[model samples]
Target chain A: MLKVHNLSVNYRGTEALNSVSLAIHAGELVGLIGPNGAGKSTLLKALLGLVAMHAGQVLFEERPLVHQRQRVAYVPQRSQIDWDYPVTAWNVVMMARTVRTGWLRSPNPRSRQAVEAAMQRLGVWDLRDRQIGELSGGQQQRVFLARAIAQDADLFFFDEPFNAIDKTTEAVILDLLAELKAHDKTVLVCSHEWGQALNRYDRLLLLNQRLVADGDPQQVMTLDNIQRAYGENLQPSERPAEMPFFC
Target chain B: MLDWLLEPLGYQFMRNALAVGLLVGVLCPIVGSYLIVQRMALLGDVIAHAVLPGLAIANFLRFNILLGSFVSGIFSTVLIAWIRTQTRVKVDAAMALTFSSFFSLGVLLLRVLGSRLDLMAILFGDILSVSRADVGRSLWVTLLLLLLVKLFYKELLFYTFDPAAAEAAGLPVHTIYYGMMAAITMTIIVGMQTVGVVLVIALLVGPATTAYLLVKQLHRMMLLGALLGVISSLGGMYISYYLDVPSGPAIALTSFAFFMLALLFSPRQGILTRRRPLRKP
Candidate 1:
């Protein structure tokens, strides 16, 4: 579980997040949707204690975010990483155990086994030995997810997980998230594809610098809310189609 | 070939020069690999040039040149890191400001201390003139540095590849970052005693970058970089000795030539200057 109150963020004198408050409970898959520069990514980073918060306190399971660091794992935006780094998929996933392993000791057999299982779960076991730079975008995303799984954290923050991924990879990631949810793990995922996220996520927090709405997907994904978040750029036909549920 | 290399062992100067060259060649690339991966090639240049003023001031006060260079390099590193973190001043601009201003101050100091100092040894090192004490000190320092790197190889590799991930992993990314800067300063100071300040950047970046173009794995790149560095250093020494060319420039040019050759012929990312066949319209 996580709690954020009056979380404000500024970038070079420009306010990105303005007094936003929210809570995410355990075992919930919450989708954060907004337009470009909508403070969605900034809010996630602030929650992870990666950014310098202007004014706010983030508590994970009633503990400060920094103190409860090991309980939370983050998968940053794929574009933020330098893809050309000389690291194998295994090495990357193993990094998740670094906090627990400490500086002096290498990953133990147990940790390594956990990494192996995480990689297998993400379907990157065959690619574990490959250099990270050589992996495709989807593979790289899966590698990060494997890292998150290896962390064995109760809470996860994923930024733009579906961006630039193929439909198949997207489905695989969604299935992984579903598995995480089943295990009582909390997930906060930032995404732009509202329609797909609306179907998958348990709760939706629609935002554009300010908190526009927060509730069930059907209630949050409305025409007026979309218009307020995106302004006049919203098209009538662009709203989520009323497709029949198959599952 | 053994006789040629072992024969120089009889002469003290030859022995010192060879030992110093080997140590610098091996040590520079060990640190240089991280520098290249971090895209801080210019940082090496900045540090090399920035140390000049400290050297000049030390010379004016009749202090140890190595000590002076080390102090200045650390100062430059801290200054650059501070500027980047505290202000919106970009990395390149900070590098340019620190190196240029410090280097000019050095030039001015040299002018003021005209004819009172023997700076030729500092400007263009005479490896043949290396004292036994100098050789001993450099060897010990290099050995310690290489040992430290070997011990902390995992941490360094993790930080270089993904700093944010390393931080999230609670690896003290900032401390590692500054630790690397300290290592680079030490390496540059040692290298300056052989290659001089002007050519130090070549030893820092040339071999490692060339190795980068050839290898995918970090360990392989480090190995190949050391190999290239040693080969180039020895080859440059022999060529310079036989041709009576300026040794410093000759050594640097040799590494540069090797870099260009690798650029053209490296298997993975080499530039094929030769024309490709035309596609059908």
Candidate 2:
């Protein structure tokens, strides 16, 4: 389990996140759904200690997140990566093993096996030789997913993994999430898809620069919570009927 | 043809110039490969120009200009990092700010000191007139850089490609970053004599970019770029010799020509041949 206490993030005199606290337990697939500029990505960065926007500590299983970095895999948004970078799918996946292998040392046979196994699990083994830029959007997502798996992290954080992806990628990610949950891996997925996709998450944390709602999907998707998170943007009638957002 | 080429070796100055040019040829593309991959080509230029003040001060103090250049290079990098952290200004604005101010100070110092041999050496990269000591220094720099690259290639690759993930993996990312900055500064200072500050960026960025269009990996790009760099330097030196032109501009132009050729003719990524997908029918 991971516990974040009184986390706050400020950027250039503006509050991006404020006093947000949450717990992510193992074997749980938590979906972080939020409106634009609601600190969804910032939350991920703060959790990983990649940014200094927050002052609180993030602990996993009673240990600081910093100590668990190797056990934590973060797949950033598609836009955050450079597709044009000169690397192959194999190379990207192999990077997961970089920290496992020491500096100036090549990957051992065991690490290579892990990388190949990760790529094979994601069905990207055949595209190993192709330049990452040449892969389709769905294939690109799979490559990153393979990298996270190759890292063999117990806690997985994916930022907008579904963006610009096809059905195959969505299926691959959903199956992987299910597999990870079965394996007792903690997963947090950030997404904007809220229609039918809202039902997929075991828990939903609706956010708007702060935690607006946190609980089972059916409990957190209330109209009042939606109004709080999307303020003045979603009237009662504007809410999608199938969403079951009770007034 | 061999005799014709050997004629240039007849003169010790020409031999020295050729040796220095060849060393820089191999060095620029190797370092430039990193800059191009990180999309820091502009940063390379900024650092290149930022060395001017150090060169001027060293000339004024009659101390080692190389030391002055290296110190100024580090100072500008620190200032840029400070501005980025302390204010809302990003790396681009900070670089623009530091590079302009440092270059102006160098220009002012040159004016105050009056244009002299040392000033000309930094400004125009008087490669042909390099002393024997310059050749030895360049050789040492080349050897040191190659050794470091060999030792830390994996770490540098991880850092440049995905800095956040590299840090998440706990690789002392900042120390590696600072080490890289120091290496880049050293490269520019050593190269300042071959192409001058104004056109040195071409040597740093051009060959690597050219290799990028043909290679699928960073290491390969570095290898191919270093080859292109050596070829350009040698070719430019010969052009300068036979055509009676300035060696610095000739080398820069030669490197640019290599890039243009790659742009137009690269097998996989050339503009001229986008590799028409084969039809299933």
For all candidates in order, the CA lDDT equals: 0.82, 0.86
Chain B TM-score against the true chain B, candidate 1 = 0.90
Local accuracy of candidate 2 as per-residue lDDT tens digits, B1-281: 99888999999888888888888889888988888888888877888888888877787789887898889888888898889988989889898998899889888887887646465556657767776888899999999998999898878887888887788777888798778888889888778887788777888998899999899998899999999989988888888889987777888899888888888888887888668789999
lDDT score at residue B185, model 2, on the 0-100 scale: 90
Q: List the residue pairs that clash in candidate 2.
A: none
Off by over 4 Å in 1: A232-235, A238-247, B1-10, B113-121, B272-281
Worst 10 residues of 1 chain A by lDDT: A238-247
**Candidate 1 residue A202 C-alpha distance from true site, Å:** 1.5
Q: In angstroms, how far off is A221's CA in candidate 2? A: 0.5
lDDT score, candidate 2: 0.86
DockQ (model 2, Cα): 0.66
Off by over 4 Å in 2: A236-247, B113-117, B276-281
Model 1's TM-score against the true structure: 0.92
Each model's DockQ score: 0.48, 0.66
Q: Distance from true position, residue B57, model 2, in Å?
A: 1.7
